[model samples]
Target: MTSMSKSKTNNGNGTVDSRRQEVQRIVKNACDQLNSEGVDARNYVEQLAWLFFLKAFDEAETRREEEAAFDDAGYERRLSGNFAWSSWASKTDHPDEMLEFVDGKLWIKLTSPDPKKGLGDDPLAERFRR
Candidate 1:
């Protein structure tokens, strides 16, 4: 993951400090909501970690894809379609569908050792297996 110091997101208007505050506010709200639903701090944090990791992975892949396009080279994505965060997580209006996809297909692809069922033999897939 890139360092926050190296890259500051202004969200197209606000300063870095304001963006930080906005993120903190969002996180606090999410924590409060999860607490009300009986999810402990540790559990919610763990789930958030998975989300953040996937988002970062998607961002990195996007960067690589752009570079490949600029260089006129072929770049195959590690994940695509419903397995990608862009394909699944971006559709916030369909929470039920997103949840079903995550539980039904995404988890299977990430965890299944059978190459036909999972991410094949990539280094990232090997790490997931561990």
Candidate 2:
């Protein structure tokens, strides 16, 4: 990661390269935690990537809320309530909870229709469904 550039993000909290490294580090930690539970390294990384995608989507929604440019702002917030990364991803205290949410419930939602959310034919939603 040190070999990567250190250009700062718009937030100025950290460099773009550093932020990617941080995500990778988090994914590694997640992989380590799940490996003991019989999850394969490759699959764990995939799971982490999916979760990160959700986090990014949720962040975009939050950004829209903070900077409301239109009535349709934050409309891309597909995941809400428990399914959102803010709820599941933020649960770092109990490692088992994170693992259970990602490994169990996450898969079911990803493949099935979320009755609570009526985001029909949404591109992101459709991708998750498949």
Candidate 3:
């Protein structure tokens, strides 16, 4: 019998940390909810889109408020404002750049066409389409 060689696997320790664990927990909960409703987790594109929109909206609003305060302070320093929602889109005219900024797995779930055997026919999708 030939000996089997084990390939070295990187766990991406550089990217995995406490913060990543928290995010994973949140995603797992959402998936679990979908599973309980007899809905395929992969068909959660609509939910993902809504969440993304809310998150981006909150971030953009917070950044705008912070930036305005800085401007009022007469601080002519460039603030690394949080790029989310239309603020992120406005940052770059290039489609690629716009995509790059929101290229996380959550964003992919929202924008990808018929991802994972295509989105199921559901009211959530209908609402999202609007």
Deviation of model 3 at 97, angstroms: 37
lDDT per residue as tens, model 1, 1-130: 4666445552354575686788789889999999999988988787788887888899899999999999999887777777889999887899898898888988777666555545565566665666
**Candidate 1 TM-score over all chains jointly:** 0.75
Give the TM-score of each candidate: 0.75, 0.59, 0.39
User: What is candidate 3's CA lDDT for residue 82?
Assistant: 42
lDDT of 3 by residue, 1-130 (tens): 2232122123345354555677779888978877899998668866576655656555666677778797884322111244335455465568687556566533443343443345564332444355
Which is the leading candidate under TM-score?
1
Model 1: lDDT equals: 0.79
Local accuracy by lDDT, each model: 0.79, 0.69, 0.55
1-130 per-residue lDDT for model 2 (tens digits): 2323333333465566677888789767867778889988766566666766777888887777667656654454456678777788777899898888877987677666555655574455578766
List where candidate 2 sits over 4 angstroms from the true fold. Answer: 1-18, 28-40, 69-76, 114-120
* Cα RMSD for predicted model 3: 15.8
Q: For candidate 3, list the clashing residue pairs, or say none.
A: none
Most accurate candidate by lDDT: 1
Count of residue pairs whose backbone atoms collide, per candidate = 0, 0, 0
Which prediction has more favorable TM-score, 1 or 2? 1
**Candidate 2 whole-model C-alpha lDDT, 0 to 1:** 0.69
